[model samples]
Target: MTDDLRLVDVESKHLDDVYRVRSRSFGLLSAGDREEWLSDVQGFIDDGRIVGVVDGDELVAAARIWAFQQWWGGRKVPMGGVAGVVVAPEYRGRGVGSKLMRGVLARSVEHGYPLSALYPATTVIYRHLGYEFAGGRFRYTFPAAELRSLGGKEVSVRRAGPADAKRFLELVGQLHAAARISGPLVWPEDKVAEWLGEENSFCYLAEDGFVVYGWQSGKLRVEELVAGSEATARALWSVVGSGSSISADVEAYMSPDDPAHLLVNKEADKNTVIEHWMLRLLDAPAAISARGFAPGASLEVDLELDDSELAANTGRWHLSVSGGSGSLTPSTSTGEVLRLGSRGLSALYSGTPLATMRRAGLAWGGATAGDGAIDTAFAGATSYMLDYF
Candidate 1:
């Protein structure tokens, strides 16, 4: 049965079939918004971004790749955000999902994306395909009243529209760079336009920050709240709290150490939900070379990468870093090798501490001398993703 399966690019005609498989795999779609959801899925199909596994004419499994520019060590790195992974119920346990993901990895490299990330429904399948837990989307819930008293001089904020896309992108770039953020995604112009056009979404732009939010069932939901300055953070969060009388609580996607939490005057019930995200390096050399490291720092390390899925990544490599830049070359000399698989390497690339990887058994067999330099070169702020797809 596996021999009969073939992976193919999903075309316009396959949209309905793909949706059926997705609905079945993810459970029933909402009756009211099915058409809107289908339209969104069709857009991905029309863009030639969806891949599917077919068993003779039936779409057995599928996934979509979202073009994104994600930050790493203060630089925007091209990222392929994988989502909508679904397999026909009948195809479960048949290895269809694995094949589909392998195809996605190959296509991502073809598209020139050095890195890829996904919020995984389960870790088993992606882990087998060389993806590792690298970051998370952290959701924080607190009473709106607690934020109302956050005191700060109000900065001027204006409603934002598509006209502000370029400026918005610039602001986000500057903010992420300053914060040394990792895993925050930057959308393409078309996506930015779509986001600005959302009827229910509210967007506010300040000189050094921005906030996008919406309402759901009488609760205020902040889709994103990015502030490059403390004053901006307090002001924007205060705006969210301005609705406290009508909305009981506010839930927002935020960094683990966001400053807005400190501005609140009163303690409220704080709940943090972590949705784990996995990452993969599609092109090991290019991915490493493209990353931005610590400024005025330098180091050298040898790595022995084991990538059964992508043979090009297998073998020993020498990495050199200087002044926030890096280069990777094939190594001939035998030395103390950091023995790791593709997943482990990816985790390290995303700033996952060497100590944690060591405890998790993702890394070992390295010379102890270079470990501190390796850590310093890659270490920065905690990595987190605010976007779901």
Candidate 2:
């Protein structure tokens, strides 16, 4: 009956079955916001990147992934964002979801994607599937003591509207590209309109449009500081300093290298560090070559990936990169190779310090702290999924 649980590419005939599966799995159908729920499902189908688990003639489980442009060092890297992952109650825990994920990841590689990212519903599930928590969302309060430390200078703040949508999108794209990591930059037209309509949510342009950032006030207190440069980002941050009454709410991931990261440290209060964006390398060779490389000599890296489902990526690969131009090939070298588990690799993929992983007791065998090429190649990268898939 294992073949009965076959994973297949969704087709036109499976729409109704897939819809019913999604409805039963997520409990979104006939729930509040019917229109929104319907739209989400239809949008995924329209985009045509969904995979399903079939049991005989019935579709029992479903997962959705979208291919989009992600920013990486002034270049738009193709990314496979996995989301809407679901399984019916009957099919739950039977490896159906995992099978779906593997299929999707394989498709990502076939489609020439270097990196595949996800904001996981459960981090642990994705871990075994070869995903690791690469980034953290720091939720801090806008405490009174830290108030003075912010907003010292005046920043010309302006409201963003439909007219500014194109520029806002462009600026955000630029910011993500320069950061060498994907930021949640892609927004559908509807989401963009809703964001524009929200009164408390305002966009601030800095340095005569050097950057554009967004902030939201109220129960879901949020601040998204997107900018082209650190100086412009800091200038935009000053605009929010005027609001002293804003109590500590949820503050999402602001880059650790950014001025906001520095200010948050100076004003750290009761905060929770929630992990965001789980990543799995579909093709170690492609993933490495997809991003920009350091300006240096070539270094040979042997990466052993543990993917039970995808046969092509499961073995040892010899990667060669010179100033970032590289090729990955299966190594016939039977010599001792560096071994890294999925979690370690995912952490490494997102620019997490190799030392930090060691400190956390996550071991990378045959590779030492002195291995600067591999370390820099792994840690020099960062990714943010700017879009909700």
Candidate 3:
């Protein structure tokens, strides 16, 4: 019976079944939400972003790949954001989910994405698929009155709507690159425009900062707030805190080192929610080439990487980084090999320390001489993202 199950492109006929499965895994959509869900999913179907497994007439499992460009070391690399994964209760113990994921990975490669990431419901399956913990989406809560005290009113603030998406991206890009930030993502203009136009969110813009937030449970819920300078940071937080008359507190997804934290009267309380995300390298050389490196980091290290899912990535490769850029090339000459699998490589790609990878048993089997250089090349700002997709 398992042998008869097959993977297929999720189309109009399969949407209902896929919806049911998604509901089972996540939560059921209400009547109006279901219609909107169908409208939303139609875009994915048109773009061939969803894949599913079928058992004759029934769809047993499904997954979706979101087209994204994630910022790694201040550079944008095409990434496939995997989500909406689910399996029927009867199919839990079998290899059905794995089968569906293999198809998703293939589609990701076919679309030319060099990396893929997901917030895993569970880690074991994705770990086996070469995804390792790469970064976190951090949510910090602050006292609304404390934010209200930080004042920078001289800076011009304006209401931003769909028309400001391009400016928003441009400002974000400049800030991320200049800071050499890691683990943020950029949405294409159309999607950002749609997001800015969402019914629930209130969007605000300044010359160097922007914030998208909404009210939830009598508190300000900040979807994102990026500021490039101390003045803008204060101005933006003041804009958020202006709601303190009606709201007691505010919660935001923030870069741990955001300058706005310095402007606040007191630090946010200890109760922060951190959701970890995993990364998988779809094409090793492309990933290396696309990533930004430490400005003064200079090194040449040979690596022996074994990628089980993507055979094209299995081989000895030469890695070199200089002047804030890096490259990976296949080598024929035998060299000092630092051996690891996709998990180690992916973790390292996001700035995980070599010693940590070794301690976790994710990496080993090569000369230790290249360790320092390897770490230096990959190390930078702590990997974190403000958005959860």
TM-scores, in order shown?
0.93, 0.78, 0.96
Q: Which digits, one per residue and each the tens of the lDDT, describe model 3 over residues 302-348?
A: 78899999999999988889999999998886745788899999999
How do the residues 216-242 of candidate 1 rate in per-residue lDDT, one tens digit apiece?
Answer: 877898988888878888888878888
Q: Which 10 consecutive positions of candidate 2 have the poorest summed lDDT?
A: 207-216
Positional deviation of residue 170's Cα in model 2 after best superposition, in angstroms: 3.9
Q: Can you tell me which runs of candidate 3 are displaced by over 4 Å?
A: none
Question: What is the alpha-carbon lDDT for the whole of candidate 2?
Answer: 0.62
The model with the greater lDDT, 1 or 2, is 1
Evaluated against the true structure, the overall lDDT of model 1 is: 0.84
Candidate 1 residue-wise lDDT at 334: 86
Encode model 2's per-residue lDDT on 77-155: one tens digit a residue.
5778887787877777778877788778777776777667888877666887778876544454444335335553555
| Whole-model alpha-carbon lDDT for candidate 3 | 0.88
Clashes of each: 0, 9, 0
Q: Report how far off residue 167 is in candidate 3 (Å).
A: 1.0
RMSD of 2: 4.2
| Model 3: per-residue Cα lDDT at residue 289 | 94
Residue 278 lDDT (model 1): 92
